[model samples]
Structures are given as C-alpha cells and as structure tokens.
Target: MNERSPVRICILALPETSASVVYGMYDMFMSAGRDWGLIVEGTPGRAPIAPLVVSRHGGAFIAGNNVRITADAPLDACDDADVVCVPELLVPPGEPLAGRFDDEIACLRRCHAKGKILATACSGAILLAEAGLLDGLDATTHWAYCDFMSRQYPSIRVRAHRALVASGDGERLIMAGGGTSWLDLALYLIARLAGIETAMQTARINLVDWHDVGQQPFARLARTRQAEDAVIARCQSWIAEHYAQPSPVGAMMQMSGLPERSFKRRFQQATGMSPLAYVHTLRLEEAKQMLETDRQPIEAIANEVGYEDAGFFSRLFRRKVSLTPAQYRRRFGAMRDAIGCISETR
Candidate 1:
C-alpha cells in the first residue's frame, strides 16, 4: 500500500500448476523492478513489486510438468499481499474442487473479504470459481474450458470471447483470457499497481505483444466430441474432405444408406449440429485458414469454400468468426506475414 515500499505479490502454487506461468510471472515481475535499469538507457527507479511464491503447504513441490519449485512461505505464514495471483492449474474442467483445494479456497475467501484483488489465469479461474468469488461476476478462462466452466458454475457470467475481464468494486478481481494471454494480466497488474511506465518497460523488456483477437477466432468448431456411431464417423470424414462440393448434405444422406429422417437424427446426435450447419462450419473453418495464410481475394476464398455468393459468405463469416474475412486477414494474416518476414531476414 505504501508507494515507497514494494508492492507484495503472493503467487499461489497448487498441485499440477503450470510451472511456466509461475516462474514466468515471478521472473517478469522481478525483472521489472530489478533489471529494467540494466536494460534501459536511463534508469528510472527500482521496480515496485516484491513477489513471493507461496503454497498451501510451503516447501518444494513438483508442478505440472515435474518442474520442482520451492515456496518462499506457506499461505498461512504469509501476510495479506497487495495482489494474490492464481496461476494456471492444469486440473481438468468439471472436476470437483472441494476435496483438492478446500484450504486454498478458504484462504482466497478470507483474502477477498479483506479486499485483496484476486486474479486468475486460464484454468486458475477454477480455483476462484471453487471459492465462489466469481459468482454473478463476468469471468473468463481458457477458451476450451469456457463452456465447461460456465456449465459448472452457472451463477458466473463467463465471457470466453474477451481477452480479459476485471469486475467488482475497485475491480478487486481480474480474469485474463486463458493460455499465454496471462501476460496480459501481468502487464495490467504492473500498470495498475506500479504505474504505466513500469508496465511499458516490463512489456518492452519481455517482448510481450498484445494479442488483438479474442479466443473466438482460434476455436475449432468441428473439433467437437464425435459420436461412436461408425456410420456417422464415415459421414463426418467424407464431409470434412468434400465440404467445398455442392449438395454435401444430400450426398452424405445417401452415403449413410439410411432414410433421410434417420440420417438427420444420427448426424445431429453425432456432431450436435445439423448436417447443413456442419457443412457450413467446415466451409467457414477452411475460409478462415485461407484468410489467415493466403493472399487470395475474399470472393475467391468464398468460392473455394463453396459459397457462390461472396456477400453471403461475408455475412456468415462475420456471424461465426465475429470478424469479416478481410478483418480477420488484417488482424491475423498481416501480423503473421510480418513475423515471417522478420524471421526470414534474421
């Protein structure tokens, strides 16, 4: 709380926690306060935050990938920190959290009651949800786990589409978009607590780039759980290969050798989408890939994906991707091309 004293950051280390995230945050924050001066021409001042790794039981423990790290202190031993950061826990979605993290949950609840801003990255939101801190608040996690988290915690308003969400009074809680975007949380916490200059210096020092697109663009719609029905499997495979061809649904129905009604029922049961919608999803995914990787014109991409009407394709692309094809290209493709050019020159 004191401007002159370092902001105390307590990072909780749980079983199966991502070692990269834990060490990454610790290193980045330390570098911000300790190494910024060495890297920059004119040093301002020492970094503001003092970070410590704390566990439920303080000691050396193995993280998700068997990377062992020792805690500076146990949660019970540590004082209330300025910020309590929850790193990505590699727990499966929809698993019960009561037995595994009851103590951690209690600690978090007490911390929140005392008004410590609780932040979670990726699946670490699981801990916050388990603690019931996120109820009635907008939150997000790894896009793959968004639906699972939403279904498990119906009271929490989950926004899998956004990159980061900070809610509650004084924004005491923050949820970064899942995965590597946790760096966004790091940058934000620095700016909020340490000042913008420190945050910018940290970003520049770490080469952390802001991701413009949300998780929606990267979702693989067709990568859903497939049904056990062998007929439906074949139908799905055929559709994946021939989605650009006209009359795919009709062809699939005939291939199934079932009555139209039977084929439709089985297909829907298998993929959780209508046959026509599946074709559209396939086409849209292909279109997105081309838009991100190729220089083809929008109309050409549309036709290649089986849309004769580029206007219709544009509308569908927007509806599904939340970005027009050209917008997607500009957002993803141009950056990728620029990165490629840089790499080639290097």
Candidate 2:
C-alpha cells in the first residue's frame, strides 16, 4: 500500500464488543502516520490512515464496559473501507454462540465480498466463521475458543497455538488471539498497510512491545472434559493421582473393571484421546509445571514426571512446547520474577 492516499479503516462497533479495543484501534491507526516521526525527531508527519467506527445503527451503542459510543457512520452507509476490523466480542466462557450476532455476520460477509481486508480479534473470529468466510481456511482465535470454533465449524482449521495467523487468498484474513492482542493486530496492520518504519515509530511512541510469543505459553492444557461417561471419569481421576506410575494405562484399565476393547472405545469417545495418549499428556503437563516454577535439575524433573530418560523428555518437551525445559524456565522464570518485583513495589 502506498502512502499517496489515506487508508480507510472501518472498525465495527457492536453492543457486545469491547470498548477499549474500538478506541485503541482508532488511536493506533491515527497515530501511526503522525506520532512516530514526532517522537523520534521534531517532525510533524502526515496522517496515513482515516479510521472510523461503524455500527449497525447510527445511534449511540453501549459496549461491554457500559460506555456509550456513537458510530461515525452506519455499516450500510460506510461501504468504502479499505480494511475492516472486528474487535473482541463479550461472551460467556464456554457458551455456544448459536444465533447471536447474525446481522453482524452478514455485514462482514458483505465487506469481504467487496474485497475489503478482514481482521478479527478474540471471539470476533466467530463472526467470520459464522459468515462462512473461514471455511477450509487456517484461522485462530483466543486459545479458549479454539476447540469450540473447531467443533462448531469443522471445515475451518484452527491454530490454537498461534498469537496471530494470516490465511486465505492474498492473506486478506488476519486473526489475533484473545484479549489485548488487538494491539498486536493494530501494529501488524499498520506495518502491512503503511511501512515497518511507521509501525516501529508508533511502537516507540507508545512503548509497546511488538514481538510476542504465540499463544502456546498461555494455553490451558487441562481442559479435557469427560463427556458424561462414568467409566472414563473414574479413569481420569485415577490417572490424575497415578500419572507418574509405570504402566498407568494398564492400571486404569484394571481399575475401570472393563474389558480392554471396551475400555479403549469408551476412553476415546469420552476424552477424544487414547488412554496412553492421555497418560503422556498428564506427564507432560506435570513436567511443564516443574520447568516453569521449580529450580529442579532437568533430569530430576524428568524423573518426577515418570520419564527415566532426560534426553527423551527433552525431545518430547521441545516437540510439544516448542521450547526446551531449560529454555522454558529461562524465559518464563524471568517473567515471573519481574511480575513479583512489580507486586512487591505495589
């Protein structure tokens, strides 16, 4: 995108959307063309973007924070946006969206059909999925909603571990995961549409960290639910206690009092994982915790998590976590210490 013309950014404002996201997006885009050079030097630069908040109704709408905000224009009236951004939507945890926000979905479909670049933050990706825009495309949302989106819309490939994912034709679809990631989306959109120098300038002015590790570190791994199966529930509870025991799957099978064939079938149906796979996951989770918090040696941590060989555990950790145990400790341990320092000061 050239800087010759101002890029029009239309931020969709809905009743369920986060108020901070809408305002922050507008501020970031508007500051990009002007704030960077002023912060670096004394130069006043020309604004490169024209951002406007558009709503279904032209009247004032209340956001998640109970703040009332009036839109710059209605969605129907604003049909010439170069980029359309869908901010984080307020929804209850683990609630199925069902028939909610159908009108917004339709409007987004229209925007995409008009060749406008589409972007989503947090649960807003649900709107894109509902609009049939993400079908057969690789998309991501907040890690919490990843499984829900994948189960609801089976055709779309969900990358739960990515902080941001760009897919589809010409990579028109941009998605950022969970809360506060809309800021990352803003910086990226500026860089893509404006220039890297412009994005860096904006970052410097705002004191924002531009690079973020993907969603893997923040993901909730113990999210497995036993689907109303008593046998599987019992097995899971037993595994929780004896995950470090040798032959955990065998012990679970015997404790379940079900035949091997029936046990495997029921386990898969309830947990969506094989019995052995579940055991390995439990061990890995325990190892991850030890790596993050404790100062134990890697070999001792491996033994605690039921792995006799440290080399094998290290390989497995790298494969699943994209970081070695030592590396994970070095990064997250320092982060935890920094947070502790802030807490102490407070």
Candidate 3:
C-alpha cells in the first residue's frame, strides 16, 4: 500500500475577522490543490480530500458568501490540521488582544505541539506571540504593528522589513506581514506542499502577482523608501550607479554639488540616514547578492563591494547581520543553490 499522504488545512476565525484574509487563503488553497492534481478526490484513485474550517465560537460565520459554515469542532480541530491559519483579527487602537485570549493561546499550543504548520496574518500575529509560539523566532506582522509587537513581546525577533517570516525548521511556523499578505502566505504554503505550477495557476486565476515568500510586502518597501527627499533620491540614484565605489558623505556632497552642511541636513531629512550609512546599507544588500550568486573569495567580494579590506568587510557584515560573511553565505546561499537546482530540474 502507498504511504498515507497527510494534507489538511484549518482556519481559525475570530469575531470581526478580515474577510479578504480568510477567503483569500481559502481560494488559494482550493485553486492550487485542483491545479496540482493534489485535490485528493480529484486524482485517479486517491482518498477523498477533507478540508475543515472552524470558528472560535463554534457556530455559523456569515463569511459574506451567503454561505454559512458550521464549525463542528472547537480548537481541537487544529490538532488534526496539517496547516492552521489564523486570520487577521479586528484590533482596536491601543488594545492588546480582545477577549477569548486564553482559548486562542491553548489552541495555538496544541497545534504547535502536533508539529502542524501555523500561519498568521496581520494582527493575528499578536495571538501567536501571546501564545508564546513566536518567542526567539524570526517573525513579522503588519508594519504598523511592529513597534507594538516589539514592545509586547521582546523575546520575538520581529522583522518589520520583510513581508513574511518562517523560522522554525521546515517552516512550520510562519507569520505574514500586512493584511493582504495572507494571499502570498497561503499560495506559498500551497507551492511548498503541492507544487509551484499549482501556485502559478492559482495566481493567474486570482489575478495576483504570486510573489515568492521572500518578496517583501509593499508596505515594508514603502517604509524603506519613505525617507526619499529630493537630496535622498539623488543620493540613492548615485548610490545605485556607483554602488561598487567608496560612498563617503563628502564624495556624495561633491557629486551632488551641494555644500557639506546643507547636503547632510537635506539627505538626513529625506532618507532618515546619513549618506555613508545609506551607502553601507546598499553595499550590504549587494554583498548579500554576491554571496548568493558568486563563488568569489571573501576578499574579492569585499573589493567588489568597494571595501578594500576583507577583514573590514567581515566586520561590517557581522555588524549589519549578526553573522559573518561566510556564515550568511552558508545559510542563504544554500537556499539560492536549492532554488537553482529546482529550476534546473523543472
């Protein structure tokens, strides 16, 4: 007999949940499973598929489809689910989490203990973090909640800059940033468990871009570019052009034809960082790419990134990223290699 394929999904819905977040996930899963021939019953001779969706209150939730789904089981439904998604909760200003806190916490713990993939959208991350599932884990929520989450759970390594965070081994625990990121997160799960072709078809049907898990959310990208003042935009353009050169503030001012004091003020006002600091960020980003794509020596990589001293490059890389260049290369570079291998196989 063939080995049993375990693929089940459960959504935990709360009161006043975001309709888009919940339905988007549901749509993606259904469409992708169909496209991939992973829809269980749709296959030639496979077991019937069982998809369950439960509400926190165990009743009919009018999810705007004229469709009412009865949640037969309570949080116990999470235990049997291969993937459990917590949709975006309705959070009032200055409030932590609404009531039903204790029950949600217990449900998350049970699901996590069973080694099920746990995913959350927007302020739903607050629920997971409060449940202590995100402690010491790299996670992200809506960018607006970054400061709040950091203050609420200092143990969680909050990444406000990224769209999604998946830190546990095999990416069992994932948190998506922003409200709409639920679409990407759900499609990503489908791709991982099902296949990329399924995800692509789903995206085509949904009229979405089908961004990869690594793609930063639009909100995070906006925040990154929020400091774009006239001077800053010019500096950014120059940095893009000369990213491989030494990017000292004096050099930037000279290139921009601005006085030193004026340039410093204008640049800081626009970009939230000193010229040199911004340049370092750009260089580090480039170095990340080099580390992933090239097999060059650290010294050569440093030189290509405009750092003459390999030791200096290592120090800067460690300061920017807690890991040395080689370590970063080992971790993320291997991921790039795996992606390349998959592409080749395809």
Candidate 4:
C-alpha cells in the first residue's frame, strides 16, 4: 500500500489589515503545491472545478471593484489544516485585536493541540504570542518591536538579529518580522514542506534571493588589517573594546603612536566613518541590544552605554530609532505580553 502525503495549509485573515502578506503566502504555497504534484489537474470524469482559496468573511471584499474575494468558510475550517498561517494585523491601543481575536486564538490552540504547524508574519506574531505558544521559546519579530517583545514576555528568549523565529520542537510555531519578511517565511515553509528545489523555483519565479536561516537581513562592516595599517587596526580594535568608556581621540592616537592628523585620516578611510561617530554608532548598537534584552532601568541602560546622563541617552536613542527609551520599552513590553499570552495558552 502507498503512504499518504500530509500537507494541507490554511491561512487565517484579519479584516482591515494588510492583505499583501496573505496574497504572497498563498502564491508561494500554490506554486509549490503545483510543483510538488499536490494539486493535480482534474480529469474529464471528475466533478466541476472549484476555487482553492476560501476567505473567512462571507462577502467579497471589493476595493473600488479592482480586487474581489469572497470568503468560503469560518475559523472552524482550520481544524483539518496541517499548517495554519496568520498574517500581520494593525494592533490598536487598549484593545486585544480586532476581527476575531478570540476565535483566532481558539483556532491556533486547536491546530497546535492536533500537532499542526502554526506560522505568523509581522505583527501577526502578537496573535501567536497571545495564544500562549511562544513561552520559553527563542523568537524574534520586527527589530522595531524587539524591545517590546522581550519585556512583555520574559519567559520567551527573544533575539533581535534576525527576521524570522521558529519556536517549539520541530519548529511547530514560527514568526516572521515586519515588511517583506513574509516572502522569506513563505519560502522557508516551502523549503520545509515541499523541497529545496520547489523553494528555489519559487524564488526564481518571484525574483527574490533564496536566503537561508543563517543569513541576516543586515550587513556587517568588514574588518581587514594590513601589515602597513597595523596601528590603525589596533586603534579600531581598541575602540571596539572600550566602546563603553569615553576614550578620546588623543588616547587612541597615543595608543597607536601616530600623530592626530594621520590617525584621524587613517581611521576614517578604514572605517568610512569619523572616529567619534563610529564609537557613537557602536555604543548606540550596544545600547539597542541592552534595551531589547535587559530589563534594566533607563538610567542604568544609559550608564552602561557610556551616557552619563539619561537625557543624553534618550536623545541619542531618539536620533537613531525615532523613539525614546520609554517608548521603546513600552513597545517591547507589548510584544512581550503578546508572547506571554501565546506561551500560557500553549
């Protein structure tokens, strides 16, 4: 007897949220499904053709008659799905989530209880976290919300370096960061569910780089030390090592045994940024990490990042992130809560 294949996907949609993620996910899955022989052509003797996608809401959502879609079923349809996807939603203040939060949570729990894969994209991670599935798991969301995720859900280990996070054994729960990361998540799912070939084909069709989980969205500056530029390299290393300390330019020049003009020119040419600017950038990056991972007070965070005054830290953080320390913490706190909710329910 032949073994049966088990791969069924069902994506849940929230009203009034971004639909691009859903469409993108659907396209990737459908393409992969065709490639994997999951969706076969109908025979002449078979019943009439039917639509594969079914919306949650009943009526067709027509935006100026340009786009139209009619929902086929409700959240209960998720029970038979092997994988369930939730797209990003615009969260409002003082409200859990609009458009079937409780129902979505129940559906997620049901799916997980039956060993189905649960995936979320962008702010949709909040839904999974609220469902209690992300507790004590290594997860990440959009970098902008990393701090909020950490504070709200202290049990879950949050990392800010990546665009996607998979939690639980066998990667049963996964979350993708904001923006176009939905594409990455869909490709990841395709690679796992179908095969690498299908994922590669899909990537080719979409003209997207098929990135591996190990790759980061951001590029790191390269550090190359030549024999002639030993002093400059050493000074750069010192700056990296003593970023938290207020090491003046004079100190760097003295350490390198080079004159001020030479040191300044060499450092700028090597690093592409002024010496003090580079130091400030490093400190700010460190401060960002501290803000996301640590639960320390604002003043402590400022001091740890070499800011003598909390106000200065706030100003720098704002300049870099367009958000103050308090605002950053609040955002991460919300994310943490969302994650905590998911963990508890799970």
Top TM-score model: 2
lDDT of 1 by residue, 1-346 (tens): 4667888899998777978899898887787755677766566557688899999889999888888989999997445687899998787665666688888888889988888888888788888888888889898888767766776788999887787889887898898877888899888898898888888888988899965566677766535445579999888878888999989999999999999999999887666578998899889988888998999999999999999999999999887777888899998898889999999998
Instruction: List TM-score per model, in order.
Output: 0.79, 0.88, 0.56, 0.55
**Candidate 1 TM-score over all chains jointly:** 0.79
Q: Which regions of candidate 3 are displaced past 4 Å? A: 1-6, 35-50, 62-72, 211-346
Positional deviation of residue 276's Cα in model 4 after best superposition, in angstroms: 16
55 Cα displacement, candidate 2 (Å): 2.9
Question: lDDT, candidate 3, residue 193?
Answer: 73
Q: What is the C-alpha lDDT of each candidate?
A: 0.84, 0.84, 0.71, 0.67
What tens-digit string does per-residue lDDT give for candidate 2 at 133-198?
Answer: 999999999876776687778899998767788988889999999877888899999999888988
By TM-score, highest first, what's the ranking?
2, 1, 3, 4
Q: How many clashing pairs in candidate 4?
A: 17
Model 2 local distance difference test score: 0.84
Q: Roughly what TM-score does model 4 have, to 2 decimal places? A: 0.55
Which lDDT value does model 1 have at 154? 82
| Candidate 2 vs 3: which has more lDDT | 2
| Stretches > 4 Å off in candidate 1 | 41-44, 77-79, 95-98, 222-224, 227-282, 292-295, 318-323, 330-346
